[model samples]
Target: MKKNLLSIIILALLVVNIGMTAFMMLSVMTTNSQTAKLISDIAAALELEANGGNTGGFSGSASGNVGVSNIATFGFTGDDQLTINLKPGSDGKAHYMLVEVVFSMNTASADYATLGTSESLAGMRELIKGKVTNTLSSYTIEELQADDGPAKEKILEEVQELYNSNFIYDVTFSSVLYQ
Candidate 1:
């Protein structure tokens, strides 16, 4: 009789363990599905691809396709490099960034014919420098030091906005000095 009783107790515990496992699995699966749905919703809202492809950090304008032949580069170096006064950080000290930038423009754009030339670019030097200065000055020294991507992107966007076109598709900092 004791042997039978022991066997019954073992069977009961095994059944209970299986039931608890099923319950936990169902709970986890439900939560996981909900989280996945949330991520999909957010991605769709942002117009992001689910495959997670990178555009090589170059965001093309218009048709979202840029060819090598369509690219034109304008650079600021030497005396033309921007020396910007950055915003004060937590330490309340002044900071500066000396940055040499290069702009990759879409030569296929209509504005490119008007503004993409070296002489035309030189004529608009102050506007370009002002955009760079305003954008860089908004960031604290520490923030700018952490990652240069955001600053470059902001400058590109501002330049695009200034001209009411995305003729300038990319901005690169060939050299940077922070002090």
Candidate 2:
């Protein structure tokens, strides 16, 4: 009788251990699934922004100190009037895009002398064009086709990071076309 009781007790313990293991496994799986869902949402937002659906949805809120109207007056702008070809996305078709960008400057910032001066940027036109060309070539067609913007706003964002802080206070897209 004692042996039978011991047997029953051991079986119960085994069952409990198995149940606990299963429960832990399910808990871990649920957390992983939730994390994956969050990642998917963020990826969708990035894709939309790349296609221009949500321009400012991601990062860097605008500096209220710089207003939109000031772009033409104080901004240094660049235009890729010529069409650019981008890498094909999953669609596997040739993509063409044209973009015009307005880059703003802060008068109070130290970068003004170098990047704020329209004449200085004008002299660097070829360099700017090279940067744009390289940037555009890196994006996929679907990214440019979403409507009014290109992937990453690479032109404005990259230039600022590559040059100096506040050298680019704001970036405005004048025109964007994808086909």
Q: Which stretches of candidate 2 lie over 4 Å from their true place?
A: 1-64, 67-80, 147-153
Q: Can you give the lDDT of residue 172 in candidate 2?
A: 63
Q: Model 2, range 1-179, lDDT digits (tens) per residue?
A: 99999999999999999999999999999999999999999998876654335333222323335555444333224534646788877878888777665555656555566666768777766666667778877888765556434443566666655664434545565667677
Over the stretch 1-179, how does candidate 1's per-residue lDDT look in tens digits?
99999999999999999999999999999999999999999987555332122442223354355799998888788788888899999899999999898888888877789878888888888898888889999999999888878988788878877777667888889899999
lDDT score of residue 165 within candidate 2: 48
Q: Please provide TM-scores, in order, for all candidate models, with all chains considered together.
A: 0.69, 0.52
Task: Tell me, by TM-score, which candidate is best.
Answer: 1
Local distance difference test, candidate 2: 0.63
Q: Tell me each candidate's RMSD, in Å, in order.
A: 5.2, 10.4
